[model samples]
Target: MYPPKSFDIGWPDLAYGLAACGRDGDADRWAATVERRFGDGGTKGPESAAGSGANGWEPAAGGGANGCLAALSVRSALDLALAAAALPRGSEVLMSAVTIPDMWRIVVGHGLVPVPVDVDAGTLLPAAAQWAAAATPRTRAVVVAHLFGTRAPLDSLAELAARRGWLLVEDCAQAYDGPDFRGSPGADVSLFSFGPIKTATALGGAVAVVRNPGLLATMRALHQEWPVQGPGDQARRIAKYTALALLTARPVYTGAVTAAGLLGRDHEGGLQERVGAFAGTDLMPAIRHRPGPALLALLDRRLRAADTVRAVARRAAVARRLVVRLPDPSMVYGADAPVHTFWLCAVPTPDPAATIARLRSAGFDAARPTSLGAVPAPPDHQQGARTAAHLVRHAVCLPLRPGMPDRVLDRMAAVLDPEDWGPAPGP
Candidate 1:
């Protein structure tokens, strides 16, 4: 069966990471190199970069000296940004309705309310007007996540935030295409991830561009106080992913699935647990830390060495083929973005459990996205996020990978044809 996801890391990078784990490299030096290389921490393109040329792309500097900060993960970065912002207790953070549950959890953890703005599954973007309607006097910030590898239109959201004096953050965790296509120009901060499942995976890390120098400094100071991750932790991660990476092979995965069934094990559950960044650990403590030296070194290397744009282009090409074959194109989520890399292409099915069974029968191991959810709309704005909630309920992602054979694409499309996977007929 086809695996549901592929780690972006290669063996060479893994080997390099393993070697770096043994070195006593200066964490500060590697972190500084990453921060400097990523630009002055503004979307202002590479000009903010201490040096440029190879992969320089940031949007706008936001009228100040921008700075970049490195963290253990995007989850860690947001925690720092929110803590530094130090918004008043009970303030509301306007957010795109659909996102990983942890993001809203982070907001709540900081004593703030998350007001979810509805999104169009096609664009994976919340309408700006909906954002306006959702924002109350208590709203102090907006966190817009670019979901499913699609870059949402940021101009209007940025304008709204600027008009209301609200902090605007772009969660580009799933939208990192490469050195180019930096976060939106109008955003106060833009976050990028390099986790186990994200593009250009460094196994685990995050980089953020902070438009406000003061906030950056505050986050930096706060980040420094957190304990550093141990080298052994990263070493285990490298080893784990290396083993998981091997299961992408069809024969091994097939045999493993059979073995799992025979042993009465929930194989998918086991996979999710293994892939989790902090599986079985308490949330806050696990994330509140400086990167270990090994992570820093590997993150810097992956940023420089990752040939991301081409990889994204290849995926898009395959996704386009799939979309063309769908019985109803609208069944596919995130098809309306200006640029969709199809990082995790999924379809909204009326019966997702049945759909997964069907895909599995056809040699595809489809699964629901356990990591994503609709940030429930607040009490006053309950109707605003229906679409986001609907999509989350019905979405089941197929296993679409780079370099997949043409036969696989054709067969996958056939499974989605009108006779097979489309919505039910009228009564």
Candidate 2:
């Protein structure tokens, strides 16, 4: 059995991420901003960092010059964008059926209807044909989600949106480190997340980049109406992030995760139950709160230190090795793209549950990626959408992170070889 430590994070990366939580010499300035915005005697200390300049918060210095607005979370950023677009109530916004359910809630919360389209089984991207088939008189926008760090067909989707006079939104929460196409010709707006599990961890934060000046102004105005995160909430977030940084550290994380796996309590659903979010059951507040200065500072530091080219090359090398060993058609995606980033090396299998169990018993962490629930099918692509859903149900994502050990990769490859294991049982 491969050690549980193989699934944990690297020591250097964890230390670097935690270093951002240190004092950045902006505490006094942040406190003054909080007092000026929320008045004196309020949640005043580090706890009120996210609440500083509630109504007056502008995008972090360099971010605004390019029309990118920062928010507390991606869900809030999307909500702000939808409101800024000012689409008619009940207008339809199409999305891939194989996405996180939180996106559905955001669209519905904005009083807009979410139309689901099927994704390409291999790429996990909705094709232009799927989008065209989903279009209708009421369709007002299309959100192109770039899943698992792969780019979507932005040029084609942009042309379709332009011809149909519909808004084009790019969901780059998982693909932030993959490519920098925010202001590209085809996309009207893009949304990103800086959560703990993302490519770079900022604890909790999100950003929205708007290409249209009118939309940016509208979003900024809407941003002021939402209540700022209170000092208590800020404190909780800081504590949570801090705890995560510590928990994911090498020695501690390995022991904790290994024990949890042994106890049968380390599955994705169980983890979600503990986190109380991301499963679409516990909805987050729909307010457009800004990320605290500390979090932003951390994000900025991480961005500066990131080497996208090297990261992608490293991931590609590992992926290629796995492909050579496993030789499964469903083991990889978008290998032919101009650029590829392996956020999660997902493989489609006939029995996802069994495969996950086998991997877990072998001391490797593996599980199915997030999927939408109860999504309504597009009027014209029901069969295609169903096919996509089926594929998603059977796909299992392998554990792959930068700087992981070669032994771990070899173990994974060995486990995937069919000769080592006979026929998989039915779900």
Candidate 3:
């Protein structure tokens, strides 16, 4: 059977991360290096106009003059941003309806309300229309998440936020196309992640591109006050992912899954807990800290060395192939986006369990996502992100990778097509 997901990191990156643990480099210096790399103003892409990537307002490619900050994770960066902004308590922060649970949890933890903004079904974007409908007097900001490696058009959202005097934050954690592809040109703050399952897995780290200089300075000061992560913890994380890399190879992974089934073990559930960055840790203290030097150095090196352009292109190519092969393309979410990297490639089915079983029979190890959920709608606006809830309820995330055999796509299409599968199995 195929593995469910591939870790974007290689052994070389892990080895460097481990070696950094042995060195006693200055965390501040390393942070500077990492942040500088994040702010590297690559030659203007056809899409982005010229902007200086300096201390002053460097429109993160035309949004605002930009600066960069490194943090433990996107969660840490976001928490710092919210704290620095100091939006009034109980203010509503509109968020894309579908996002990792921690996102909304962190918003709630900061004494703000996370209001869900339903995403368009095909593009997986929270359009301005949805935002207008979701907003109220309490709405103070919009945390627009570009889901499934697709970048949302932000100019309109930015205009809306400006007119309404609301903060515009772009969660690009899953949409890192490459160095040239900075966050939305209009986002006040753009967050990126390099955690285990993210595009460029540094094991653990995050970088924020802050368009507002004052906000950047405030966030930096607050971040510095937090304790640094222990070197031992960084080393342990490196070791854990190293082992996981080996275990997730096709041969070992298939055997492990088979063995777990024979022994009635929930291997997938166990793996999920192991891979979570903040699993079982005290949220307040765990996220409220700076990354250690080892992690910072490794993250800098990864940022400098990664060929995200090639990686993302290949992933998108594979996703396009799959979409064309599928009998009903509408079943796939976010395929309509002009630029999608297929980070999760989730396809919705009426009976996801049966669909998964069929895909497994075809040697695919697709599984339901445990990480994404719908943010709650405010009290008076019930129905609560119906489309977001619908997508999550029936999503069967298929395992699609760049180098997978083309025949795999054909098999997945056959399994997904009702004509081929003869109506999904019933209870």
Which candidate leads the pack in lDDT? 1
Better of 1 and 3 by lDDT: 1
lDDT per residue as tens, model 2, 1-427: 3222121223454444344345343422432332222112112222333332332232122111346676777787788888888899989898877677788878888888888877665566766677887787999998777777776557888888988899888888767653344434678888877665666555566667777889988987877676654434444555655565565555666677777768977545654443432433345563456555555544443443336446657765776666666746444644434445666666667677788777866666676665434356545434446645665667677766556577777777777757433221211
The model with the greater lDDT, 2 or 3, is 3
Error of 1 at 305 (Å): 1.8
Query: Scored by Cα lDDT, where does model 2 land?
Result: 0.60
Give lDDT tens digits, candidate 1, residues 195-277. 99998898999998898889899999999899888879899999999999998667888889889989999888899889878
Looking at model 3, which ten-residue stretch has the lowest summed lDDT?
Answer: 55-64
Question: Quick one: RMSD of model 3?
Answer: 5.7
> TM-score of the candidate numbered 1?
0.91
Mark the regions of model 1 whose C-alpha exceeds 4 Å error after superposition: 40-66, 379-381, 417-427
> How close is every model to the real structure, measured as TM-score?
0.91, 0.78, 0.91
Q: Is candidate 1 or candidate 2 better by lDDT?
A: 1
Off by over 4 Å in 2: 1-64, 178-183, 232-235, 249-254, 261-268, 274-287, 306-309, 329-338, 371-374, 378-384, 404-407, 417-427
Output the TM-score of candidate 3: 0.91
